[model samples]
Target: MGEPLTIHLPDPESAIHLAGPGEENLKLLSKQTGASLVLRGQDLLVSGPEGAVNLCRRLIEALAYLWGQGRSVTSVDILTARHALDTNRTEEFQALQQDVLARTRKGEVIRAKTFRQRQYVQAVRNHDLTFCIGPAGTGKTFLAAVLAVQALQANQYERLILTRPAVEAGERLGFLPGDLQQKVDPYLRPLYDALHELMDPEKIPALMERGVIEVAPLAYMRGRTLSNAFIILDEAQNTTPPQMKMVLTRLGFKSRMVVTGDVTQTDLPEHQASGLSVAQKILHGVEGIAFCQLGRADVVRHPLVQRIVTAYEGHE
Candidate 1:
């Protein structure tokens, strides 16, 4: 609506080859900044409002710098540039950044205000395997499910596999009625809810039937190799150490795994090591493995939920 904004880059013969797919980068930047961007020669033409235009220019410069430095520029970087261009104070933008990071293709960004949600997303994008440890309401399971949905939508993986331990938090699963899925459905419902948000409910059953999406008990993962899949292990604290080893070993080439759990909420009996906890200790310093510990400050739920988590922490 305002004056057109243009950005000119000096022709550096040495950096010309560094452009490497400039059109794609321009498209990505335009999407993030909500500004139409076109490149002619060494000039970038962005026509938008004064503020948005200037912001786009800054973002383009930043992207060129990052690319020139050989740093990977991900979607996160695009969002970060948008945040920096829009806001003067970083604290508010940081909160917004967390929301942007919590975004998934299946649904909108997480509404809850928690930094842990952002860290969880970052871990998933940056690592081959991510361990998200936190208390309830931290959006651990929900965020993981969202990432799985995004991976599927982007065709980054062939399928989505969601697994959780069958162990009841306190009750007995035997007391529940019906078959195995019926018995475990209560535990797996959260995952289904996430999927429904990202995809049409009608499509879910078809995908499940076709094995494009699978919801199963952790025990069923034994003796199988999972390749080209976005695998998520939820409520991992209920798994025993041997079970954890078996599950981790099942990762086939080109598969990414995310394990989410609350260490403080472990239901495992005393003297038995929780697989999540054990993995945290054993996998530390291991290359290609990432760990993200979410604290009470990262809880992105009702205000009361944060207070409740803090009260529990006080008792500990």
Candidate 2:
């Protein structure tokens, strides 16, 4: 129906990377542009209506830009690429390329995957106290953990402190396994998982033994002055106002704190108020503090997880 065009890639060897495994990236590009893509030698043939072909060309160039920057192309990357073009954020997207936060165990870059996430990262970096409230799978805890480890590794902070309220086991905290540490271990497993992802697994034991990385229950934080540390309070919604106040007051000099949670998932009783909810209202306009809210659109987990979050949000 329209003219076909052959666009040759400058680095032809990157075609496979751009196209993804089994030509999946091409499939995604076709879905997005409604253009038929054919890979021939170093050139990709685009066959479709003229507008679609033109859009496809732009997408290929965007993909080329990321690949040229040595970043892997994923389906989410394709979606971000489309969003960038539709919203005229292509240049801003290019700037995001240089903001690598940390790397995972497999050396995968852990930068912000979306514009909103980039804002959260900026807030964490600029503010001494930050609160990120979002649904599950939104990278609220994970990103904070990544930045915490990065700061600790860079010696910006002398230690890393992670804590979360044990809401599910409210009065049963002492009824669990051996000792206090073992009793709360299950509740703090998520923090451990994050640490293992960002820091070396073998090195964690020694670091924890030396108190460089401390993962403990929120109860352990009372009456302690945590200074020169990067502290993260996950699952803050389960905390009460008094607990939040106490922990926040413990923040000492030269320290940064990030509190992350989902108020919607608060397990508190009907008459009880969520500490994070109260903190959101009280600490919002305070200087040196930031609060970032992310929604279902920011969920970076599996596609179905996003859909599930959207469905629950709608039903509510």
Candidate 3:
């Protein structure tokens, strides 16, 4: 333990702006530094161990610099600052950061360009199971898939399984297809696209054949237990409570699972309840599990996509 320390900002104007625009980043800093921060007019009061307080001060200063430049502070910026503080503290911290960063930046790794994506990665690393809830185009599925792939490549997991409910999104799968794979291929194309981006297209087939990677409909996972695997259940909002329970209970030793969905995009008809919505309530406060609620601001697609999502949300 160390002594408490406080920092005073330049003035109230800057303080107001930091508390407004930089509030989220500041909260993240508080978590990272294990400090309690309270703003009193122009002064930022931080109470914690001396080292942690000093690190928090440096983080606030860095944020002030960005805010002064008209740049918005992000979660990634806070994480980077935390990494810097750790590196400055000890060589062991630098080594750990290098190892984590290396794994995070693999050959086909999709860099997190938004705050939500960065938080998603952090949540996955910190928790055994994570639920990423958001609207479409928020990179929920893609990022989860990439993390699964990285786990597979690094030998962290023996296999990767990508599963999703085969609920028809206004299209009749039975009317349009050759066989089951061809029928569900449309639903799973997004998963395939993610794989193609992260791995050689030609090699993917061989990997699939070897069972190192498996992408299948949620129905196929009913009875089996999954162990030593990285499992992703996308479009989970379409799953029924029974289905969600079944899927979750299937986790065996050394397995990690990520369930992602958009509550607004549920395709289970108007009468049925969304499993994701239910799971959020049921799983709250459960240890070793994480939940991330992403908003329209987290969308990393075309700039207009974010606006469109915001527009729809505003109308609702």
User: What is the C-alpha local distance difference test score of each model?
Assistant: 0.75, 0.88, 0.77
User: Candidate 1: minimum summed lDDT over ten consecutive residues — where?
Assistant: 12-21
Score residue 99 of candidate 1 by CA lDDT: 49
Each candidate: how many clashes? 1, 0, 0
Name the candidate that leads on TM-score. 2
- Pairs that collide in candidate 1 are 106-198
lDDT of 2: 0.88
Total colliding residue pairs, candidate 3: 0
* lDDT rank order: 2, 3, 1
Candidate 1 all-Cα RMSD: 12.2
lDDT of 1 by residue, 35-67 (tens): 887667776678977767776777766455444
What TM-score, computed on C-alpha atoms, does each candidate reach? 0.67, 0.91, 0.67
Superposed model 2: Cα runs more than 4 Å off = 9-13, 21-24, 38-43
Query: Model 3, 300: alpha-carbon shift in Å?
Result: 0.6
- Per-candidate Cα RMSD to the true structure, in Å, reads 12.2, 2.2, 10.5
If both were scored by lDDT, which would come out higher, candidate 1 or candidate 3?
A: 3
Q: Single out the weakest 10-residue window by summed lDDT for candidate 2.
A: 62-71
